[model samples]
Target: MTTALIADDEAHLAQYLKQQLAACWPELEIVSVARNGIEAAEQISAWQPELAFLDIQMPGLNGLEVAQGIEGATRVVFVTAYDDYAVEAFDAAALDYLLKPLKTERLLACVARLKAALGRPPAVDESRLAETLQRLLAPPVQGLARLRFIRAASGDMTHQVAVDEVLFFHADDKYTVVRTAQGEHLIRTTITDLAAQLDPEQFWQVHRSTLINLAHLVGTRRDEMSRLFVRIKGHAQELPVSRAYVHLFKAM
Candidate 1:
């Protein structure tokens, strides 16, 4: 039996896709379902599924990084909502993909191709995929205006801080902290919301509740146990990087 794995941060979306896949390809066995990139990467490495359905913007490593790290024969079918990603590039690379708001018709076509491809040798070119990811990351997603400033409240005083000055954004109970070299301010905005508004190239989500400005990054540190932590310029404290996002700093 052909085995597969589905990886998406959204639980409901992953379950829905599983249901749809059961209907579309009843014979295929879905060995695992992962809710984050780290989980997905580990599962893929352990199971070595014949196919992997990867969501492009997953938490932890993100889909591109996860796909890049795969060393097995698992063929990938990208599941993404970002229409800005070049469809022609995916096609040219012989990579199958399903767009968000997935249609049964499109999925059926993708399933057919995958089924046929499995009968032959894996033809995916990892180098091509890497190049594609490079291009995709270079261009900013259109239609979303990058946040230039934040208005936050600190005790009795409200302050306006330029987005560039922000060292990091950390979740603190009911509010999020807007930290800069000068000081910190509390904001009602959630970390997830801030991530969406911030420039993709500048701000990187290091944890579920933390987003750091790469420009202000001092360096990374590892403890005795080899756990990773990130240091910010002008900030005395180090921020913990989640296990899932540790791959982001491996190059450092």
Candidate 2:
């Protein structure tokens, strides 16, 4: 039996897709269902399913990023809400792209293609997909492109924190902490992943595990051990600055 993975941030959508797949292709077995791109990547790495149905937009990491990280013969079908332009791009590149509000006919066609590709050597050019993802993620010149809000989880509750209110971000073990004037919230995204999505002029990485908002920066001080620390405008705690990033405050 061919195993598959369904990855989408929406739980309902993932279930709907699974039902549709089961109805159309009884031979296909869904090995896993992921709620976010991070979990999806982990499942893909662990199971290495024969096929992956990845939603384009997801928390922690987008579908493109997850797909790029995948190796070997796992065939990918990107599920997107993007317009015809993006669909055309994928079609022109010979990569499968499924539009949102999935139709049964469309999914049936995709399943047929997957069945044919099963046992065959991977024909998809991942390099081309990487280039396409880069183009899609690039911001326009008219304005700065950055996340306006972050969805953070705290135990059983989820909070939507505005980006401007964030004081700093620190990596804590497996999760990254999003600190704001109110308090700190946990996010599944890694520090490295958050760095790429934030505006460089506003958020600066002072250490390997710490990123601070320049608006909240008050000043910098050196300790007795010659260690550099950054002070926040209204916050009491001082964040350490690594030697690699100390050059950022040399002029100050």
Tens digit of lDDT per residue, candidate 1, span 1-252? 999999999999999999999998999999999999889988987898888899988987677656655645677788889765637446533358888988999999999988888888766554455455544544434576779999986678878899999999998767898989888888889776787779878998776568999999989887765657889999999987754456567676
Which residue pairs collide, candidate 2?
none
The digit string of per-residue lDDT tens for model 2 on 53-117 reads 88888997777666655543466788888866448446423247677899989988888887887
Query: Best-fitting candidate, measured by TM-score?
Result: 2
**lDDT of each prediction vs. the true structure?**
0.79, 0.77
Q: What is the lDDT of candidate 2?
A: 0.77
Q: Which stretches of candidate 1 lie over 4 Å from their true place?
A: 86-89, 92-94, 138-252
RMSD of each: 8.2, 12.3
